[model samples]
Target: MELKKILCAVDLMDTVNPAVEYAKMLADMSGASVSVIYVISSRSTYENLQVPVEEIAKGMRRIWSRSREDMDAFVAAYFPGVDATGFIYEGKPAEKIVEIAREQDVDMIVMGTHAREGLDRLFFGSVANEVVKSSKCPVMTIRPEKKSE
Candidate 1:
């Protein structure tokens, strides 16, 4: 396939992920531009915050700023010597990822899956699963290799 753009969704929780490498490989082969996206699942309005409005806004800005920093670091660490765009958004991760992919007209999306099961899966929905279901373009999900006992 002739891929012009790719969106790679990464959660900063993990120090490393195989999905990044997969994205890089695909981009290298297809000559596609890669865009890294990280979403902060935070409520838009901090209704519970008793602090002043300015303080609340400032706090939100700080959080976003830190996220941007982390995104930059993640991109640099994962995609050395390669130019990649970074995007940070505040909202549900799956929705935001799909939205960004659509907006950017990406040809494919690459992301890592935690492989949560049973009760954990029920409690915390799978962002990868949701993105695959909702995304307009093809999505590639990489699950980390299981350690041998």
Candidate 2:
């Protein structure tokens, strides 16, 4: 398919190189722009508390800050010709990814998923599953290689 823009949604747990490489290759092949989205979905433990929100927000900022820096450096050095933009969003990951894909008019979306089965999948919802079901455009799910192997 002819892709003008591609949306890549990644989290802290996602492997940086493979996903980025796949995105770059797609962008190059399709002459599309790649936009990387990272969402900070940290939730407050206490529903009603006087705890400082900035405490969590600050940590999120730092996490994203370092992540983005690494992402930028990688993109610039490796994907020289691809136009790359990174975004930070807050809220539920699956919903935010769908929102961004629609908002940005991305033609295709690529994401990575850690094996979520049984209680893990039940307790924590699957972002890739949700996005594939709800997205207007096509979704690509990448399974990372096992670190133990």
Candidate 3:
């Protein structure tokens, strides 16, 4: 299919790198503009830093700045010359991804899934599963193969 726009939701973990790669390949094949979204999961604003608001904003900015650079590097290496946008938002990951998909009208929602053990699944939960269940558009999950195991 012709994918004009794609929303790639990343959790900024190593395991999710394959999802980014899969989206890059699809975008390369379909000539789609890629929007890479990373959700901060909305912590309590910030910890008491004993600093000014400007400083806090600057800190947040720095964090996002690094994220942008990292994503840019990955995109450049994989799918060069494709128009790309990276975003950082604070909220529940599944909700933010769905909201961005609705707002941007992306053709596909791409994300990653981890094989969770019993207790990990019990506590941390599955953001990918939630997104798959709730997203307005089609959700594509890429489970990268494990090398050693």
Candidate 4:
């Protein structure tokens, strides 16, 4: 397939390099541009909280600023010398990931999965699973290698 753009979804909470490496490899082979998206899942929680408007605004700003920094750092570390766009969105992570993939009209979506099964999957709610089901483009999920304890 002729790939012009790739969407890389990162949680910034787990091991993010592995998935990014796959995306970068694909992009290198297909000459595609990469867009990294980090979705903030705490927006709804903040909105539902009984907090002052000013406090909520401050909280939101803090989250946005920190997310931006993290996203930039991730891109720089994983995609050095590559032109990658980093984006931050607020809302449900799975929903945002699918939405951005559609909006960007990406050729492929790459992400990392915890590979949770059974009760763990149900309790954690796999973002990779949701994106795979919801995205129109091809989805590639990478499960990080287990760290040696």
Best by lDDT: 4
Residue pairs of candidate 4 with colliding backbone atoms? none
Q: What ranking of all candidate models by TM-score puts the best one first?
A: 4, 1, 2, 3
Per-residue CA lDDT of model 1 for 1-149, tens digit only, reads 68889998887756556589999998888888899988877654474656687887778788888888888888888887665888888887898899999989999999988877789889978999999999889999998785112
Q: What local lDDT score does residue 1 receive in model 4, on the 0 to 100 scale?
A: 82
- Error (Å) of candidate 4 at residue 86 is 0.5
TM-score of each: 0.85, 0.79, 0.78, 0.88
lDDT of 3: 0.78
Go through the candidates in order and give each one's C-alpha lDDT.
0.83, 0.77, 0.78, 0.84
* Poorest lDDT segment (10 consecutive residues) of candidate 4: 140-149
* Predictions: Cα RMSD each: 3.2, 3.1, 3.7, 2.3
Candidate 4: tens digits of C-alpha lDDT, residues 1-149: 89899999887766534588898888888888999998887656776778887898898898889888988898988898666899998888898899999988899999988766789779978888999998899999888786212
Give the Cα RMSD of candidate 4: 2.3
Give the Cα error of residue 145 in candidate 4, in Å.
Answer: 0.8
Q: Clashing pairs in model 2?
A: none
Predicted candidate 2 versus true structure: per-residue lDDT over 36-112, tens digit per residue: 88777745532235667777666667877887786676557756878888777777788889999999999999887
Segments of candidate 3 deviating more than 4 angstroms: 45-62, 147-149
